[model samples]
Target: MKIYDAPFIRAADRYTIEQGISSADLMERAARACSDQILKEHPDIQQVLVICGTGNNGGDGLCIARHFLELSMPVKVLIHGHRESGTEDFSHHLRRFESAGGICESYSGRLPDIPQDTIVIDALFGTGINRPVEGTAATLIEQLNESGKTILSVDMPSGLPANGIPEGTVIHAHHTYSFQWPKPAFFLPENAGYTGSWSILDIGLRADFPGHEHAWGEWVDSSFVLPFLKPRKTFSHKGNYGHVMLLAGSKDMPGAANLCSFACIRAGAGRVTLADDGREETRDEIMHLHRNKLVPALESGQYNVFAAGPGLGRTPSAHTLLKQCLESFRHPVLLDADALNLLADDPSLTMLLPAGSVLTPHPGEFRRLAGDTSGSLEMLTLQQQLSARWQVTIVLKRAYTCITTPDGKIYINGSGNPGMATAGSGDVLTGIIAAWMAQGLSPTDAAIAGTYLHGLAGDLAMKEQGGLNIIAGDIIDHYNSAIKILRA
Candidate 1:
């Protein structure tokens, strides 16, 4: 799914309104969908309190309240502004709701004593909000948050910017039912608290409306990644998959190398070679080359892809190895863990990076690579800047991993959970990306697909292991299952 900002959404709404269907009809469609979903999800909702503003969003709430009234459920509307001052659609819905015997009350300075079981619908603001919420609006939002009741927001949480970071008081909604498409702000980690769990309510807008505008980024899901996954042929041999050379593992942190190697093999790499300093208890299937042999191996051109860092320490020798790898490998390499740390330590090594190289950095590592920022939005800007400057793909690892390509396209992975936050998980990601690159995927496709599959594997693991004790190895264990689901 393509992510659109406020302007694009508004344009799409206007275009939708221009396409024969009246704005009121669109509002009714959106309201009916939301009300139906709410009724289905919360069948026991005895009372609903819709806090409405003086805009179209408020109109949606009014229509929803009327639907509830028709069903013989007790519903009330608390209008923040006077009904006469509302928009044409808002006034229309308000009059219609009132005619249907719906009870409406003005929002005074104080909130009424809301029952714990009553569902509160927040329709005070929508995606068009561009300024900080203040005065009575701010107070109402704060009070609603404090009410300890389930709050469902219409279109957007009041005071939350559609495209940028929240500046002031925003409604902390339990869930937000977005109309047409999801707002770009919903994907940002900074806005996660305000958005909670959001779902897009399709209002039957014109499909071609977004084609006229540019999308901020793509929401990476199964459908988005299905095309990138190539089916295996019956006649293909092991060599057809491609060989991956992994320069990982140190004496004390040997588990990183093992985890990465296993994950690479599991992700469908035909061959995996590990360059390490004679670590004990190495896997039998993995070919090993001494640390000194890495330079010669890079010159040999036998490997299709290269991945470094994992357990590689930040020692002088490690720096030398990284420097040598950068100087020798002309192809795109997957760098993570200490490799990224080494680059942050010595800024000049970044220049040596091959074009289209993939850098997977967790927040701490990203802060080191790109200068520290105030929040996720600024960090995203810096991520994009660094990607353009270095001409590499930067996978900023997080709960929602963001992949920014050199060409300025962003892809956000919507998979994985908190369970994948364990140690060595990034190493597993590095292995997966390396495996994809080795299998003939371009640096960009490999990064996006690998991130998606890595997260999906973690999700699968979470389903079985219940996400509490899920380790990095567990993600690797479910790699094939993830692949099967994607392939199917």
Candidate 2:
């Protein structure tokens, strides 16, 4: 799914309204969806206190009030603005709700002493809010936040901008029901606290908007990635799948190479040549090379792709070898772990980064490649900045793996779980991406698909193993099953 900014969302709404659809009707539909979700998720709620503003968002709140009242459920409405101060549609809904015997009180800068378990519906402000909320509105939000009630925000949390970092006080919603598409703010870690679990509530707006070509970003789910998958031919042999050269591991950390090579074959790579120092426990299906022979072997090898630097220790020799590969590799390549660390050490190495190369760096690794940043927004900005500058795809690994392309488009992975935080996970991701690249995927597509599939595998593994018990190997073990789902 494509993520839209505040302007595009407003334009979509305007486009729908211009297509002979009444604004009041659209608001009613949006509110009805919100009410349905609330009733479904919190079936045993004691009461609902709808806090409404004076705009279309408030109209949505008023419609929700009427909906709950019609169901004979306990509901109360509070208006932050006078009847004459609200939007034309808001006034329409307010009168209709009142005609249905619903009562509403004006905001008096103090929260009413309601029941303890009342669910507060925050419609004080929505996506149009562009400044810090102040005066009575700010006080109301602050009080509701501290009231120990579950606050559900409409469209967006009050005071949180649809894009960019929020500057001032914002409503801390326990859940946010967005209309049409998700806001860019919902994906950032800085705003995660305010947008506590969020879901897009499709309002079924008219699809007549012009220039649907531009996208803010993508939400990488199975459906979005399914089209990129290539099916295997019945007569295809091992050579058709492509050979992957895995360059990982140091004298001390052989497990990294083992994990990367294991994942490479598991991800459907036809041939995986594991080049590392330790070679005591080698599988018959896997090829091995001593670390000392890597340079000559890379020069002569006809590998389709090279997955480098999982456990390649940050030694001078490792750095020199990485620089050589970056400059010499004709096929696509990926750098991770220590390779990223080496890039941070030598800024000049960035100039040698091959075009269409992939870099999988965790937050700590990304900070080394980029600079130290405060939060996800800064990190994202820097990630895009570096990606465009280097002309390479940067995969910043985290709970939500963010893939920034050289053209500056960002894709956020919607899969994966906390179980992926264990050791050797990044190595597995590096291998998976390289395996996809070897199979003839573009650098950006491979990064996006690999990140999503890796996360999906982890999510599936977490279901059986639980988050606490899941290991990196579990992710590798489930790669085929995850691929089957994506293919289907």
Candidate 3:
């Protein structure tokens, strides 16, 4: 799904109106979607408290209250601002709700008595908010938060800005129901507290709306990636898939190399070669070359892409080997773990990186390479800038791993779970990306596809292994299943 800016949402609404769909009709569609989801998810609740403001979002809340009343559900509706100072659609909905016998109290700057344990429906503000929330509304939000009640926000949290970090007190919703698309705030980690799990409800927004094609950021989903998958030929053989070289593992962390090599094979690499210090156990399928023989191995044209840095213990020779790969290897290269640390120690080592290489760095590694990031938004900006500056694709690993291309485009992955956060996970990712690169994917496509597929494998594994018990190897084990799903 394409992630668009706040203005595009407004433009979409306007375009919908221009296409002869009444604004009131659109409002009803949005309200019904939210109401249906709420009813389905919280059927056992005895009462609901709908907190609204004097805007279109409040209008949505009013419509929801009417629907609940129709369903014979007990609900309390409260409008926090002037009842007369809202959009025409809001006024119309307010009158319709009142006519339907939905009692609503109007509050200017003070909140009315809220019933205990009632699910709170927050509609105080939406994506149009540009400043911090303060005064009576902020006080109301604080009280609502302290109420220990499940809060569901309409469109967005009441106080979150569409683009910037939340400025002040915000409604901490258990779930945010966005109409048509998610705001940029929903994806930033700093705002995760305010914008809990968000889901987009399609309200018949036109996909071919003017200017829709200009969106730069995208949410990587199955539809977005299925086109990138290259089907194998019936006559294909092992050599047809291309070879991958992985430089990983050390005396103490040999398992990292093992996990990476195993993942490469599972990710469909034709052949995988590991160049290490010969301290780790090797799989029969992966050819091992001693660290001293890596130069000759490269000269043999046996590898199409090179990946380094997982579990490579810090040493002078490790740095030298990484430097050699960066300077000598012309094919796509992947750098992770200690390779990132080496570059952090000597920033100039980044200069030796071939254009279109890939770097997989978690937050800590990213901080070492790009300085401190105060929040996810700051981290994202740094990711975009550095990827563009270095002419390399950087996969900044997190809950929603973001892949930034050399041209500065960002793709936020929508897969994986907390269980996949265990040891050697990033190494598995490094291998998956290298395998894709070896199979003729560009560094950018490899990073995008590899990150998505890796996370997806983890998600599939988490279904049976559960998040807490899931390890990196579980993700590797589910690679075939993930590919099966993707191929489906």
Best by lDDT: 1
List model 1 lDDT by residue over 59-90, tens digit each: 99999999999999988889997778999999
Best-first order by lDDT: 1, 3, 2
TM-score of 1: 0.98
Computed on alpha carbons, the lDDT of every model, listed in order, comes to 0.90, 0.86, 0.87
Prediction-by-prediction clash tally: 0, 0, 1
Candidate RMSDs in order: 1.2, 1.7, 1.6
Which scores greater on TM-score, model 1 or model 3?
1
- List runs of model 3 lying over 4 Å from the truth: 108-113
Report the C-alpha displacement of residue 475, candidate 2, in angstroms. Answer: 0.8
Q: How does candidate 2 score on lDDT?
A: 0.86
Query: Model 2, range 407-438, lDDT digits (tens) per residue?
Result: 98989899998778889998988888888887
lDDT of 3 by residue, 361-394 (tens): 9999999999987888888998999998989999
My TM-score estimates for the predictions, one after another, are 0.98, 0.96, 0.96
**Candidate 3 weakest lDDT stretch, 10 residues:** 108-117
